[model samples]
Target: MATTPAGRHIRNPQGTGGRLRADILAAAGRILESTGSDDAVTLRAIAREAGITAPAIYAHFADRDAIRRTVIEQTFTQLATVLTTAADTEHEPVARLHVVCHAYLDFAARRPHHYRLLFERHRAARGADAGPAAPDVGSIVGADAFGVLLQAADSCIRSGASTAVDPVASATRVWVGLHGQATLQASLPWFPWPPADRLATDVVRRMADLR
Candidate 1:
């Protein structure tokens, strides 16, 4: 729709085409978030949203999966960043974990489709990454978030936080608990839960209460 606006796509990243690529990727991200990395993320759709055409998407992405992968990868990294920052804020072992729970839920509620496209919707369901989703090459938040949970559980172990004392299991349970609340909120919004953030905070509190 908008004219190439002078040297648009032809310009390299930072050299000339800065605006075009940015616009395409952002549109792709929104499409992924809103549409669950479905068929709509096609070059044509992205281009259409960008007021361009299929050729424009090709210029930006290798193929549909590449774009989907990029969007998914970036989304997880962002989710991890939110959790890590929350974990960093508090001093108490339990409270630190609670911060992570709230942060994670906050991210989900605020970006429900992005959250769903990332974790809740199975890749098979969407027909993306057919074999399985690729593992993170060099993770940003997912691995870091797990590390924080492990560290907290380790503290729980050292401080006699619970009788059921397997650090990995404990950490996993916490993950499951928090994710359970989030998943319910995401997948079945009609089932009646508190606000997403509240449900998540409650789960986190309950997890820390383990004895």
Candidate 2:
């Protein structure tokens, strides 16, 4: 914990002050997670969790929705980085895609809260968009997240590996299909029994026509 000038101990061990910001984001995530990651988050509750004046949030985020966007964007960026790397070495389209899918499922399973906050939330509170000046982190990292799959899928199309290899369709297919499995696995793991890897591999093989 870092000591503030006022002799109060801060929970931020990283010393980046992002710890405070992260705490606020985390608290907001908690509210959204417990209630639903929608418009339920309030500045007062988040401020209480972060142990600071609510208005102080204005210094960092323009409003509550701004923090939501930041939190979701950061979550996607982190997912993109992880899933992108998970399939780094595999050159085969289907194999590479499977690894990426597994990486995504693993991430969602481990951080269901972040996953839900990023994709499931309807909107946020105290909300105002960060605006034109702010980076569109959604498209940015989303592109990265699926970049490997696109590259490999395109290669398969060029090589006549899959006649269905239209880039947009293929990319969208993999994304939707992968997200379905990941979402199910993360949110409702008890519905039935099948190994995630096996089921995911079967899905990818069928979709990509992998041998």
Candidate 3:
């Protein structure tokens, strides 16, 4: 066992390589959460947080971009699971849609740093040079999360609970509103805002055209 620069004892223990990978990712996540900036998630910082040498990180991740991508993927997975569970709690189409909206808001509120990484920072990273063909947030987060939101919106339309003609368009509108709301709430927590549940419900109803 060797002591890392952070004065923490570290041990690879031969077959724990998989575990080390997970630890590296976890440490990176903590750094992102604390700093809320990708620029702060340097290899040295992650290694220090993980109690491992910077070279060891190279064994698991090719570079900082790989680590960041993995972290974003994990965050999206968590959000999708939460939204799916929230939607399952209510059987009615309209109610399920509202619940999913609340879950989305809850995720943003609970993990502001992760939310920033996923949306704000991600957009900045994609850059204007990425061109029109670059993948957007929905694609980047993948089908799991965005699919849940779209499915919920489609459910409302299929059940006649929503007056929207195009589920895709309606879902896009709902996503836009939810993102805006979450961003505003996180940036202006001191502002006088409506209750979270009430605000989320209103956004869903209006955006999804839910009856």
lDDT of each residue in 73-111, candidate 1, tens digit only: 677778778777887798676666667767777787788
TM-score per prediction, in order, is: 0.72, 0.74, 0.87
Q: Give lDDT tens digits, candidate 3, residues 13-32.
A: 64468888998898889888
Q: Local distance difference test, per candidate?
A: 0.66, 0.69, 0.83
| Cα lDDT over the full model 1 | 0.66
Clashing pairs in 3: none
* Candidate 1 Cα outliers beyond 4 Å, as residue runs: 1-19, 33-37, 120-141, 192-202, 205-209
Model 1 pairs in collision = 1-51, 11-17
Q: In candidate 2, what are the lDDT values of residues 127-174, reduced to their tens digit?
A: 335343325423443556667667666666776766774765776676
What TM-score does prediction 1 earn? 0.72
The best candidate in terms of lDDT = 3
1 or 3, greater by lDDT:
3
User: For each candidate, C-alpha RMSD in Å?
Assistant: 5.3, 5.4, 3.7
Cα deviation at 89, candidate 2, in Å, is 3.0
Q: After superposition, how far is residue 61 of candidate 2 from its true place, in Å?
A: 1.3
- lDDT of model 1, residue 51: 64
